[model samples]
Target: MLWKYLLGFYMLLVTAAAFLYAPPALGLGELSRIIFFHVPVAWVGCLAYLVSMLNSIAFLRKQKLEYDRRAAFNAEIGLVFTILATVTGAIFSRYTWGEYWSWEPRQTSIFVLLLIYGAYFVLRSAIEDEEKRARLASVYSILAFISVPFLVFIIPRIYSHLHPNPIINPGKQMEMDARMFRVFLASLAGFTGIYAWFHNLHSRYLKLKAKFEEAEKHA
Candidate 1:
């Protein structure tokens, strides 16, 4: 309960900090405020996919349905966040670049990435047998995740981006203002907590569904 309160408080703090304390960057003006929300969700989405991949690996090795549920649910979460990230990034683009979207490397790669996971859901729905579905979905999640690092990290570098510079850059040793950075870090923590909460609930729900189906079959 305290953790829930902390999560809500964290979000409120980030919203306030995004609007009030995180001053507009030199070039982008107030539109840069979207960073507090957009980046965190996108980061969480990417993280979820990575977890899905690991779960898939476990499922394949152990043939356990629980791992499949994990992989499936996290992929669903990842897709939702990816959609949010795309929409928010589009809004940020419209304000800064005068277009909703373009063939910019970052946007292109992300769009392609979305398609890859979009196919995952479609694939899951198309399959009928529960155990079979889990196996194939696990395979798909693994392959999809293998491509993710390239989509998120490498493609942006290969093609030039209309996206703005990152708040912190390791190679360039760059960073955002101290105040802005602190709020950004808080936003990340809050969203990560939100992800954990949803993940647990979703996983439990799936397990319950399986149990109910088993009871019904016996009856």
Candidate 2:
């Protein structure tokens, strides 16, 4: 219930900020303004996947059904954010790179990640045994998680492309001004808060679902 309230508040704040603060931060002239939403979504997507991977590991170690549910919920949320990130990134590319998409390594890796996790859900659906399903899903999640770093960092470094280099990298020129930074940070914080709220909701839903299934079997 607290999470629900927090989510509602965060969403309202984000919507207000998007209208009131975001435009000025985009230089009000550059299309790079999309980064306000794009960067935050991408960051949250990666963060969600990391949490999913960690939960997968925990499930494997503890054999707890709750961990499995957390992993699944995180992965689902991660997928949604990733899709938003990809689409927003494409829009940015069309404006900046003069194309809708390039065969950039980072982009390719993101696509692969999306496909892998999509397959994970398929695998879960095909399995009939609950224990077996959890075990297999956990394994696949770990493997996918291992690949994320390579996709996000390693592969992107090996090639030259129009995609911006990592912001935290030293010696990389930052194109953003101070005002843009403020709005960007705000968007990120707001989105992250929303993600946390959703994660709690999804985990609770999973727990309740498990309980319902258990009770049904007994009845």
Candidate 3:
């Protein structure tokens, strides 16, 4: 698909830019390089959660099984990305701060998000009725997404922590230099393509699954 080609090219370009073009930060040195990877993964994870929330809202409004499937799959992908962000963040923190798992505000917020959505899958598995599962999962997804903003934006500001300045400042400022900015955006675009590729593949799988189940029931 087009996404596959885009993702491939993006990967190659970002790899080159990350290793070659992106300059080290004034203080962070080579460690600043992690931001190119970390920020995009974190951003896409949030994007997936937002998509899940939108689909959840659609399910509630339309009472459609398809919408619920979209919600579930997207949330699942979001949870995976959140985990990647957390792990990578911790690793980066380790190199920069001398340890992992300091229970920093940012780390704690993402950890909470992970638990919230991890329970989403659990709740679905615990329920046996298809319609009931969809209904409750939709509700839970909305509730889980409600905390995303608080965890991501509010917590970081509330606590005095070691995390560096944000890319976008509260007053709509850009924090990065020209060289860093270019690679950061490229990595973000590439990661987004990766998200679309996975989402489309998973969505198709869900459709095939429903069809197969329907055919089996008739047989």
Candidate 4:
């Protein structure tokens, strides 16, 4: 309970920092403020997908429904974050590139990633048997994650686009303003805490739901 309030307050501070504390970039001006939210959400989205894949692997090894449930919940959260990242990126692009979306490499790659995860849910729904669904979904999720690095890290860099240089430039050095970097790190920590909280809440809810369903079956 106390942690929840702390996280809320911390995120509020991060939001205030994005707009009020961080200075505008030379090229992007006020629009650059979006980075605090955009980059962290994107990072969280990737982290969620990675967690989903790891849980999927665990389920494959142990054949436990618990792991499957965790995998599914993480994938769902990842999908939501991915959508948020895409929308934010589109808004940024609309202002900076004069279009909401031009099918550039960055946009195109994320779109493809969205489709890949979107299919995971569809596959789960189409299967009737719980064990079969979990097994197949686990396999599919593992395969889908294989594309994440290529789509997010490689493709964006391989092609020329209007996207600005990341905080870590090609030389792999931090080129961000000191103040901006501090807020950026704070934002990342805040977002990651939010993800951990969400994952815990979701996992608990699923456990309760499963118990309720079992009781109903027994009754």
Q: CA lDDT of each candidate?
A: 0.84, 0.79, 0.87, 0.89
TM-score of candidate 4 versus the correct structure, residues matched by position: 0.92
Where's the lowest-lDDT run of ten residues in candidate 3?
A: 151-160
- List clash counts for every candidate, in order: 0, 0, 0, 0
The whole-model C-alpha lDDT of candidate 2 against the native structure comes to 0.79
Q: Rank the candidates by TM-score, best first.
A: 4, 3, 1, 2
RMSD of candidate 4 to the truth, in angstroms, is 2.0
lDDT of 4 by residue, 16-117 (tens): 998999999888899989989998888888899889999999999999999998998998998999999999999999999999997878678778768978
Candidate 2 colliding pairs: none
- Per-residue lDDT of model 2, residues 88-158, tens digit only: 88887777777888867767766776787798899999998878888999999888778767676777677
Off by over 4 Å in 2: 2-10, 15-28, 152-154, 170-174, 214-219
Error (Å) of candidate 2 at residue 15 is: 4.1
Assess the local accuracy of residue 190 in candidate 2 as a C-alpha lDDT between 0 and 100: 84
lDDT string, candidate 3, 41-70, tens digits: 888888998898899899999999899888
Which window of ten consecutive residues has the lowest lDDT sum in model 1?
148-157
Q: Highest lDDT, which number? A: 4
